[model samples]
Target: MKPTEEDNKIINNRRDFIKTTAIAAAAFMIVPRHVLGRGFVAPSDRLSIAGIGVGGKGKSDIAMFAKSGRADISFLCDVDTRRAAESVKAFPKAKYYKDWREMLDKEHKNFDAVSVSTPDHNHAVQCLGAMQLGKHVFVQKPMAHDIYEARIMTQAAEKYKVVTQMGNQGASNDGTRILKEWYEAGLIGDVHTVHAWTDRPVWPQGISWSINKANVPNELDWDLWLGTAPYKEYVNKLVPFNWRGWWDYGTGALGDMGCHLLEAPFSVLNLKYAKDVQCSVGSVYVDEFQRGYFPESCPPSSHVTLTFPKTEKTNGDIAVHWMDGGIQPVRPAELGDKEIFGDGGSGTLFTGTKGKMMCDTYGLNPRLIPLSKNENLNVTQKYKRVIDGADGHYKQWVDACIAGYGKQELSSPFEIAGPLTEALLIANLAIRGYDLKIDELGEDVYPGRSAKLLWDNDSMRITNFDEVNQFVKREYREGWKSITL
Candidate 1:
């Protein structure tokens, strides 16, 4: 896709700003070292971050960046004042705004980077808007709400020449590197099947939207909160949380936990976009005789299977099973009956030609099945460990932003996070497809439930099932902009 006229203007403005900043830096560099005060850091050496969604996880994200001591929280934006109260108090000097568009419009020149921890639906637009202004971005995962958005965000990161990091902090964990080393060492041979399960939905799902509308909270800007999503009347208790169960604003269990659970497999197996997907979801009944049909809400539970083309590390195709809503795969026979499966709550299991291995969420506590194998296992540490593992994830991005694009390696840059997120969203297509209804001879039938969806990654579409294609790239609310290349 070609850049729009507005895009060209933004690009040109960013280039001019860079040129001006470079000249200023050059002049400053010529000053004598003796003239400067002791312990003075150059303005260019520190990263100024503008945070969007500065509350809840957003609040913590910015806090971690501030903790790096290299990042200055210069601006904060959140639609809900109540949710943002803690962050606002924490960063008293940071400029605050309810609308992110206004913050970026007026203050883009002041910040060196942007941190986005908004709802899944708003991630792509916020991140892209920052990148267009030549600002590096650290966005929460899944990187985008839909597959198409993920692709665009990944491409935009490179096109704009900005450092990017997805908020899958687990990517920086030592466990991921350990798994990669073990896989490369042929300890588990060739992994052919993988199962990742999560006990999620901890929020409501498989339900209908409330019929009664509630008064909008005094502290929240409802419209801004719904950016990129269709406008809806205010519903009780939907702000601080609960949006995860709805399709319009969240990507359900996959968006919430898939990145954390799947990052290790992606890193170890060199997995990219999925080739095909199929799924079976648990159903809810409205009554004893009738099943509930609430398409807007994600199912209570789902087991999705995604197939990937063979990679260099794999002998053939690979099947990845994703289970959510407390459903889990059968425990491997290698595991003793008394042994806990996947940290008890949620975990990932890898089945290989030679053996099986497993890890808890965030890829922690990885071990070969039978427990005994891990005792004597010794694999050379090939990948350098992050300074503080998961805790370092925020600092890694902060440091990289200060170092400039392409100067440092990130654990979950858009190139990696995009494809990983896309694969997860594609699996969601099957889950959503399961509920698609078609009228045949006046009787409703779900053809999508029985068909395996074929994916054409290049086109970002489901080749066989057209109904689900609507979700590949969702339509934003009338005034909200859609992501463009």
Candidate 2:
């Protein structure tokens, strides 16, 4: 139809408007990746992490996440500026804060997840706070200060539906998988006894807390550093490291290496909370005449025996022995006179019905006893290995966070780590119980040393010894929040 110039112009404008509107509607129908599910981030998107304790192990942890090339270290927090200097210098673009509470409060929206590498006592509080905010967490080993805290952290992860990973990097190692495959294939049949030992406490133990308070360093926030622990004056050699020996701040030698050493048994045998535990600790002497009793510090050494109920992988109960502070199990008879047992300093040995196998720390260098049995021996790999093995731990967490909760499997998720941690803490209950004192006839008597502590996993307490239950759930200092699910 031949139309006037104005009519033709109006028709052309209407056609252009309809085409634009249809394009807009199509774009709207294409949902954003985030709307797909909780924590569902697009592949191209980078994860923004707020590190709560960015020093030492914390520093290396966040750096590993950055190495994944999928994460952005957006915020850094530490109680000590001197300790944090290297991290700040490495991640200059990241905003820095001294108090983790302030950082989480003000910048929660800016980050997608939180990495907690603080001291043992503070792990639970910081982790729970982040989970309450719907933030994923990657906490350092042991996960919590107490058994109660570990249980709460485990439940909180489920309740909040947030992804969680404990920093037991060895759980990702191929050695663990190899051991598992060997056991499942009946190469090592029905492991009934496990011995895990370490030469730890390279730091001080069985010592008295310094009475001479040192002036707080200018670069450190002493009060903040004592978070969740009882108020104590700043003492020399406590910061940066040594807190591990003191009961108030650290979990002692067992806490330091149990996760690394005992992880193999837990993974291979599916060992959970211990039903009972007993221990004998080495004592320090102030002089030849008198034995030193420093209840405030972990003993110089100890031998702990924990009994776990049978699992599908086991024929009956299992007895797991833990030794630290340079103690080790008796050398296997099959081992040659000169052959090193457990990498010289630390190792784990599994004594099964058919044969025995051993590995060094972090489940590395696994081999059968008699050592000759390792020759020409091959077991089909039943489990897929994590790329790059143990070193890939950090990237694994980053990938899981991007994939959302319940979408991917983690080597040391809280479900697994919580029980492993509780077992270690349970062993600690016996160690601490060994030092428990009661006054009788005007003289102190140690009854805990004589009893084998019975544990009730549901109640999270020692049924036989009430005093040790005090350690199961400690009292947080006034004004600091306690962990709750």
Candidate 3:
């Protein structure tokens, strides 16, 4: 209807508002190609990253990624405010959250990749969830809590077509590559046996969970920190450290150090899954009257042996020994009385028919055992070196993610890390098996001591011992199930 000037002005204003709103909505619907996802990011732009578990190792990992000069730390998530304070200070602009699930659900599209330096148990679920969302991932060592999870994460990386790397930065070190080259040169000959040892379980081990519960700290969300781990009363000193000794929270000493100490052997020997595994663990004599065995706690000491079928590089079957809790093999004759063994505290020794070779933690300072040979021999370097060596590990991954999956090579891609981690966890199965205690006819009996656990790799089971198979894929607590690929 024909109206006065004031009514006409009101109608025109309403029409302008609708037109502007529609235009803005349309522009939003047409997302910037870079904002679509990392898959479409411009090669020139910095890759965005979101870090879960940004405390302890997670803190250092994110710092390295930021230092790479090609990545952006866009988000930080951690369960404990006290532990997370440093990261929050470091990335003041990035949003923070207590639960990783909430962070990812709300901001999955904002970051191109995720760094998981959480405990061993949560690694699988976090990695799988990120991969499911088509995000690249870098997880800390001892890839997963169980054998099955390692296998699943390995497969998920390939299936999702996402760039992935395990946090075994040593895999990027020159030592592993140099050792490989030496082995290939036939100087060490075919490695028939390997001995990797660590003085871990430095935190308390060989004990039971405290029956007396302690007050949960106000700065921590006890339930969220417990994530996939089963519900339990909080114990003082358990968070941020001693949890490594508990089965529900950690994979024990092997999980803590195996990835670092055993990586070189896996790289040099071209090893895969073990054909069989057996172990003998030392008992903690808490009291002179009775030796204590805490099923929930990792043993104070252990010696595990795993036999691997010969690979293309090996002449025959090879046996690998893993010792933790301060146990180490007899000193090699090539090492002088005063010469420190495997860099003193922890080391890897590869015994060969021709000679012995050794290196310290993370495969650093690799050397031929005779000392003189290490000083005299010259071998051509055939492998590419990371820009900053060990520090390059983080950059290598960030660069790979930016370059997109399958476009660049990585040091510890799942293909290599998966089998390597599986080997460590398989050895752990024997360690966990060593703790088995069953009550038979009102008397205690140990079933794991029966015989060597025969492993059928295809089936992922101990063919002979049924009891140990339960550990192959542990049961997750309700509502904390693993993510599907």
Give the Cα lDDT of each candidate: 0.92, 0.91, 0.88
**lDDT (tens digit, per residue) of candidate 1 on 414-481:** 99999999999999999999999899999999988867899999999999999999999999999987
**What lDDT does candidate 1 reach at residue 136?**
96
Best by lDDT: 1
* TM-score quality measure for candidate 3: 0.90
lDDT per residue, candidate 2, 180-205, as tens digits?
A: 98899898788999999988988888
Top candidate, metric TM-score = 2
Candidate 2: worst-modelled 10 consecutive residues by lDDT:
37-46
For each candidate, give its TM-score against the true structure.
0.92, 0.93, 0.90
- Candidate 1 lowest-lDDT run of ten: 32-41
- Compared with the true structure, model 1 gives a TM-score of 0.92
lDDT for model 2 comes to 0.91
